[model samples]
Target: MVSAAYRRVNGGHDLAESNIVIYTHPTCEICVTVKMELDEQGKAYEEIDLAEFPERWSEVEELADGDRITPVTVENGEVTIGYHGIGCMFYD
Candidate 1:
């Protein structure tokens, strides 16, 4: 189930300021590590467990150049695949 929960800003529905999605696998240690950082930073993001939705594989496939990986983070129109603390800087 690819469920998402987001908050509205300025009492309006503006996706530009409130769109963050995280694609992750349940057993990925890297995903857990990255999530911890996000939590510590007080960042609000939606996590999609691919393990529940096999159909979403196509979505990940469209982004994958060749290698298959989880914990794909998407903010705005930009995408950062894999978990790395360096990329977390972009959130700020």
Candidate 2:
């Protein structure tokens, strides 16, 4: 079972300015951690909980390029899967 979210953004920095969307679920601690980091950074993001919307799993797969990894951070088509992975820099 996999889940995810879609973020539609207008700006690139703040939640009030841009809409950073995170696809996540309550069971996914990684998802929680991702939100925490965003919160700590003072960056705002909208979270799509897959547990509530189960059909969005395909979206996560699509973003993950077929891998069913939750909490994948995507910005400007760049994808960072799992914690501390290369390429994406949502944590940094």
Candidate 3:
């Protein structure tokens, strides 16, 4: 389940000034860690669980252009394929 702190912005909904979407699986430690980091930073993000909605896997793959990896992040219109800890920055 996604944390209530993060809002679910999808289907062309208008996002906040900072919009972030993360594709993750429940068992991925990296995914959990990254979400924690985002929470600590006071950043809100929408989390999509591939395990729950396997149909969304293609979205992540399209963002990666073939490489499918966990912890895939999309901020605004920019896509990041992996976690980069606290140093990771999302652009608008």
Clashing pairs in 1: none
Better of 2 and 3 by TM-score: 3
Q: Rank the candidates by TM-score, best first.
A: 3, 1, 2
State each model's C-alpha RMSD to the native. 9.0, 9.2, 6.7
What lDDT score belongs to each candidate, Candidate 1 first?
0.59, 0.61, 0.71
| Alpha-carbon runs more than 4 Å astray in model 2 | 1-17, 86-92
Worst 10 residues of 1 by lDDT: 1-10
The residue-by-residue lDDT of candidate 3 on 1-92, one tens digit each, is 55556764453334554488888877778888888888888888887877777777778778876655788888878887787632221222
Per-residue error at 42 for model 1, in Å? 1.1
Winner by lDDT between candidate 3 and candidate 1: 3
lDDT of 3: 0.71
Which parts of model 1 are misplaced by more than 4 Å?
A: 1-18, 85-92
**Among all candidates shown, the one with the greatest lDDT:** 3
Candidate 3: residue 29 Cα off by (Å): 0.6
| Decreasing lDDT order of the candidates | 3, 2, 1
Clash pairs detected, candidate 3: none
> Which ten residues in a row are the worst by lDDT in model 3?
83-92
